[model samples]
Target chain A: MAERVRVRSMMPPGHVRTPAYLRGKVGEIERSLGAFPNPEELAYRQKATARPLYRVRFTMAEVWGAEAENPDDTLDAEIFAHWLIPLDD
Target chain B: MPHDHHDHDDFHHDGMSPSGHPYRADNDTPLTYWQVMEIAIRELLIDKGIATASEIAVQIDTMDARSPADGASVVARAWTDPDFKGRLLQDASAAARELGFDIGALRLIAVENTADIHNVVVCTLCSCYPRNLLGLPPDWYKTRAYRSRVVKEPRRVLAEFGLTLPLSTRVRVHDSTADMRYIVLPARPAGTESLSEEQLAALVTRDSMIGTGLPKSPA
Candidate 1:
């Protein structure tokens, strides 16, 4: 079964992979892109630990609300595992 | 006063100032602060013996040698060969290697445009492009407007580029990252079955590969 997830609303001050617009939004995991070094830590020249990266899919409506021209259109973004929360439904 | 006017005459028309130093036009030739930082870092790295200047020059030369033509050839081959398309869709980096493109550590993903779905790629954080296959990205790809708005309004963005898709067609925007890059394999245009691979490649534009526009029909 496909996993449904929501982007965390946390806003930390440094390099981050999650875009601000996507914060607190819901999306589905398309696929696992395997583990990659955490770029957030890498930016500070710190040793980066590998984290699972997943490609998340979101409908235009989910992102832009009623302003979307095509609600059915989808956008995919690669988000690190640490940035996503698995939903209970 | 005559000597001062004579000194002005001594200034070369080819961007040299009256002081006999090379001068860059304020409007046309100033490097951005980021560019200046890049130069400083590169020189510092070389001075520290971390990397040689010649190695940097060779890397730049290799990047300069790549163009849209390389990507066009890949698309053309995919259009003509079903097996090759399968491989390309399954493992883009490997398939690109088969065509002699040495994509570095970053994974390359090939998204196909179909009758029902069209794909577009963007890098919201930074401009992460498939330079190994398509050379440097256009300036517009690195703009703030494009990075912020393309995912939100892909159809409208495509329209601004003179590419209007039917309402029934779905637009999928792929956000690229430092770890992965994406390229769109545009659908083959109609009435080009008789054309050779070389001729078909000529129809593929850089924008089409980027998914902002479509390939031109044969004229």
Candidate 2:
């Protein structure tokens, strides 16, 4: 049987899900929401298993303008494991 | 209350009117032969039981009612209430649901706009959008060029639409991958402090939320 590659998110500076609007920015990892079979796979009827889901927390100024809002406010976005990759700290 | 027009096919008129216009003439744009084929695929899915007409109708109904009223309420509350805003950033779908909107099976993300940064969305692969909240996307939003190039060079693309952000402004591009989608919450424009929620919603244009245009104030 062919080895199945583990699905992961590559949120690099130049990846698809990592929007140009959020490059070189920083945010906190808020939660680990459950994931299901990847939609891209299911769109083609490709059989798959459940994956991982995450919600990345970012400040409005961190993603957009520094003057976006008060330091207290922030934004959270849910993403799949296939759309994220760990950055070297 | 009047029945939602898109709830049933009884109100879903597919044919051109006497003046060659669809019931909703505002979005009546000409489609090429290929676009017709694209729609056929969705119909095929329904026929095959992979999806259902009712499901698609629900999607349509979701679109019909997605006005700026909901978005404006979210933004205004975010500006005034710290906790509500926190929930918005933490989980947009739940936040929206708390405000009485049905996100239904649609996963969402909230993109907050600040003074110097902007966020824009495009479906580089397909027109994957949060149809439940934002309504059907405009034809221009689903174009091949816009899909292919928006992420690569957003500033230039936005400029073509007369959205020229200053050099100081940062632009973020989000590609709609999977069923996950995004909505832009533009910073409240100046000179609208005295407006009501309805008035604020009027200024919340679909284009602005998609990051193609800026929120406008009453002249």
Candidate 3:
């Protein structure tokens, strides 16, 4: 079974790799991109820890509700593991 | 290479630029805060003996030398060689390096444009692009309108570029939110089976690789 995840909707300020549009949206894991330096910490000149990243795919409808030009079309974005919350369902 | 010499030079179009937007005098414009910060950091790096002035010039030259031709050649080869295509799909950066392209640290994902699926690349936060592979992005690609509209209405945004997909065709938009960059491996145009590898490359336009348009028909 494919793993489903939801982007954390936290509103903390400062350098964030997670886009505002993708926050709180549910998507499926498209693929794991291996571990990379956490950009959020790297932006602040801090000793960044490596974090696993995944390409998450969300349907247009899931992102834009009924306003989606084509509900079936999809959007993919690289999200750090920390920004994603594993959904029990 | 004079110290006071402004960076703007050459390439004058009439009123409207090729992308249907007016050309901006951005090179001669006053430096923004970020630009000033960049100069400060670079000067500090140079002063600290971490890098040299000539090294920066050479780096700029190297980046300027990378053009769509390099990517077009990759696409052309992929269209012809199944083995290379497989490698390209598997690991785009490695595949590009295999072709003698020095794409340093660019984690690229090459999405294929099948008959029923179309792929587009954008950066919502900023203009993160596959610069090492395709050279500098067009001015439009860096604009707020493009960055915002692309992820929202990709089809409509593509239509402005004069590309219209069939009703059955699905569009996939890739937003470069982090380290990874993306490039579309545009499907080869039909009737090019007889064309040479070089000839096939000529059809791969910048927009085609960016997924805003399709490869040009044989001319």
Candidate 4:
């Protein structure tokens, strides 16, 4: 079963794949996309540690609150496991 | 037109000097700052024996040879073959390879656009596109407005592209990253049953595959 997770709101001052808007927001894991070399470290040409990547799905309302044009809409982002915290139902 | 140098000098003598103006910017240099930097980096890399010029040329040729036709053919094949469509939705990279397109190290995912669901792709950090199949991404895909707004307000963004989906349809936006890329397998348009594989491929526009628009109806 896919797990629910929340994006960690870590404001590191370097290259990152997690968009700012998704930080600290709750989302559900849609799928496991296998493991990949950490891109955050790869951007610096350093040896990248492989990390599990997940496809996370967030509702439009969860991301944009009342400003969302459609509450039923959803967004999926490829986020590394290091940036996510498992959420309990 | 012969013997007009003196006449040209006289014409410019009213406000400007006969000699070139000292304040004039040098417009003869064809390379922009970024292009100059790119050349410098390429030369440095070559000098360091990291990559050869021939290798660079081959990479350029490979990128130049790719176009929307590759993606169109894949979509067309999927539309005609149910098993292939299953393979595509299950493993897009391998499915693309069946058509002679290797999507490199990055994983490729194909999201289906159906009557109840619509999918759109974006890359918020950078323009990580499926260039092997779709060629270069359009300029708009790289803009900040698109990278930021598409994930937040996809319905409005699609509407801006003249696609007003039914309110009942759910819009799902996919944000591609360095390790993963996405392409939309748009629903086959109505009245396209009579079209051949090649004709169906012709109907698959790059934007449609990107999920910003739908395929044109058969004429």
Give the number of the best model, judged by TM-score: 3
Model 4 score (lDDT): 0.89
The model with the greater lDDT, 1 or 3, is: 3
TM-score to true structure, per model: 0.88, 0.63, 0.90, 0.88
> Candidate 1: DockQ?
0.73
Query: What are the chain B TM-scores of all models?
Result: 0.84, 0.72, 0.86, 0.83
Docking class of 2: incorrect
Q: What DockQ do you compute for every candidate structure?
A: 0.73, 0.09, 0.84, 0.79
Task: Please provide, for model 4 over B182-205, each residue's C-alpha lDDT reduced to its tens digit, 9 standing for 90 to 100.
Answer: 989999999888899999999999
Residue B13 local lDDT, model 4: 61
Model 4 lDDT tens row, A1-89: 23889899989998988888899999999999889899889989999999999999999999999999898899999899999999886
lDDT measured at residue A61 in model 2 versus the true structure, 0 to 100: 56
Prediction 2 global C-alpha lDDT: 0.68
How far residue B50's Cα lies from its native spot in candidate 4, in Å, is 3.5
Ranking by lDDT: 3, 1, 4, 2
Clashing pairs in 1: none
- Output per-candidate TM-scores for chain A, rounded to 2 decimals: 0.96, 0.58, 0.95, 0.95
Interface RMSD of 3: 0.6
* lDDT, candidate 2, B1-219, per-residue tens: 355545344435656554555665575688888999979998899889998989988867767888656666776666556798789888888888888887677777788889877888887766887777777788888998898666555777888999877767766666665457788888888988787766676777788878898878777
Query: What value of lDDT does candidate 3 attain over all alpha carbons?
Result: 0.93
